[model samples]
Target: MVRADARENRARILEVARQALAEDGGTSMNQIAQRAGVGPGTLYRNYPTREALVLAVYQLDLDRLIDAVPAYLESHPPVEALRGWTTELVDAMRRKHGLGDALSPGLHQSITERSYGPVIGAITRLLDAGKAAGAIRPDADPRDFLQLTGALWRAAALPEDRSQPMLDLILDGLTAGTGRRTP
Candidate 1:
């Protein structure tokens, strides 16, 4: 088990690394350690390598997103919850792409395996809720929704303003005949 101080240092390191990665998409262990206010030795003891550190950061981000589904559902109507979550998911995909080129192939594979299921489940829940609430077409498939989102994220070339229109299109397609008009 990790001691309290070690856990704190690890959290601090991840926090610093996440910001550095967001700002530049490239950062060194020494830079992370300095920014975290932890010594190099402490950072190494926690992460051992850049890939490990990055993987940890990615996992933490995914966990927060996956875990927020329930709260989003409780706090917003089903369609609104799905809309907000999709926006967040798109941002996460952007960050993931920013870091993807830097991770080792093995780490990338591990990330895929670790991250896909929770994301799929969260999205499926939102889709299910939307359908049950009559905010989405009864036949709207979660797998199809996933595919559509994947395509959008992969496009990467779409202008920011245009992407929302595309998202609105998808939402409209999914909600047609269900009485949920795009807002």
Candidate 2:
């Protein structure tokens, strides 16, 4: 376990880095350290390079997103929880774009797969719940849910309001005829 002070410093660095990357698309370690109110050495001890820092920030975001799933499931019916997750996911994708072309194709694939692992698991759970509740098509597969999520990701680049309609359409497709159409 890290010391409390060290943990605080790391958390501050990650918070500052996440905001900085969202605003600037690319941020320097010096800037992150300065904003984090930590020395360059401290920042380096926490994250040795820009890539390391950026990846950590993105992973943190994905982890947070995945962690929200259980709460959503508890408070919402499965289809609503799925919709909420998609909306949250779109926001995450938008924030993730702040990495600003820094990731190479290979790195993007690798990182995306890693990041999507827990998310896919959460989605599978949601899909299973939906099926059990008759809120989604019985035949809906996790891969199909991923394809739908990809559509939401692509649609997120559109004006903010435009994405929801598309999400609703996809959700409609997912939930129809299992007797859970939202009318």
TM-score list, all predictions: 0.88, 0.90
| Candidate 1 lDDT by residue in tens digits, 1-183 | 889998899888988888888777667889889999999999998899888898998988998899899999999998889888887787777777777555778987888889878888999999899988888888787777777776566554465545566788899888789643468
Tell me how far the alpha carbon of residue 6 in candidate 2 is from the true structure, in angstroms, after superposition.
0.6
Model 2 weakest lDDT span, ten residues long: 98-107
Mind giving the per-residue lDDT tens digits that candidate 2 earns over 86-117?
79987877777647755556656767888767
Q: Model 1 Cα displacement at 139 (Å)?
A: 1.9
Each prediction's whole-model lDDT (CA): 0.82, 0.82
Overall local distance difference test of candidate 1: 0.82
Query: Candidate 2: deviation at residue 56, Å?
Result: 0.6
Worst 10 residues of 1 by lDDT: 154-163
Q: After superposition, how far is residue 98 of candidate 1 from its true place, in Å?
A: 0.4
